[model samples]
Target: MAMTQTQRFGIFAALALVMAATRIHHSTLHHFDALPDASWGVFFLAGFWLRGAARWAFPLLMAEAVLIDYVVITHLGIDFWSHYCVSAGYWFLIPSYGALWLGGSWLAKHQVGLRLSTLALAVVALLVSESLCYLISNGSFYWISANVPAPRSFAAWFENLGDWYLPFLQTTALYVGLGAVLHVLAVQVARLAQHRGQTQH
Candidate 1:
């Protein structure tokens, strides 16, 4: 189903809020340490629901992510470039997040309905996209970032990947899964309302 302009705006606003709220703590603040960043899931869902708005929306979200990081890092009285996460590898986030967006876009294009098949397809898409994103981000950080010492190797990189992969994957899956549930519930509610209106008429 094509989303109306109002629906698009609503989704955009919601995604922006989620990115800001979650990332504020993600970057530096330990106060909200329990809340993992929703960036990966946000980009994925944006691609699914706001595919038509990609020309502008994708860039907007990317800007928002950077802006959020800038604000948080600066607020802490630290120089942005000097921050540990700010490295040559940081630029790779464009392609990393793009991988997620494309995955969701692929699923949206191929999705038939809310069936088991659709669920299976979504799972496959999520796994593929997340893996690719992780590879780009994690591999770049390990191999290219100055933060890692000069003695990096495939053996060490593989071990480093293992250490962080599960946490990132689990956090992303949690948000995306919750989004899926909300989507299902919203669809059912809309259908019920429409059916009641028809019956009344």
Candidate 2:
């Protein structure tokens, strides 16, 4: 979809806000747990909604993610570089997240409106992209990061991948599912308004 500059900025701001709010800290609010990090979903939705802004939007979001992580880690009195999650492998997130963006972009290019076929395509795209992303991020950490002890083997890596894959997949799916629902609602409302205008005419 062709979005005006204003629309692009608005969507960018909203996605940035969601990422900031959810990425800052994992905590409970009024007996309810906070939402999981929305970084993965943000990139996917940004690709779908602001495909034209990929040149700048993607880098900005990546920077935001790093900044948030730095702040959170430093606040806890830990050195950023020495942190468990920060390593040479951490740089692999570029390709990891790029996978998601590409998936969403492909879906946006092929989608023909709200239909089961479109939904099916979206699910497939998300699964393939997420799997690739997990491999890049998880594999990099397992093989390159000092965080994982020596004696690394494919069997061990595969076991590690199995241990964390579902939670990450579920989190991404939850946010993407919400985004899909909102997209449907917005499209339906626009169609309804247009229909009413035509009927009045």
Instruction: Give me the candidate number with maximum TM-score.
Output: 1
Candidate 2 lDDT by residue in tens digits, 1-201:
356899889989999999899988741111114578887888888888877689999999889988988888888898998888888998998999999999889899899899999999999989999899899999998899998999999999999999888877888888999999988998888889889999999
lDDT of 2 at 105: 90
**lDDT, candidate 1, 148-188, per-residue tens:** 99888999999988988888788778888988898889888
Worst window of 10 by summed lDDT in candidate 2: 25-34
Which pairs, if any, clash in model 1? none
Q: State each candidate's clash count.
A: 0, 0
The superposed Cα distance between candidate 1 and the true structure at residue 63, in angstroms, equals 0.3
At residue 51, candidate 1 shows an lDDT of: 81
Which regions of candidate 2 fall more than 4 Å away from where they truly are?
Answer: 26-34
What lDDT does model 2 reach?
Answer: 0.85
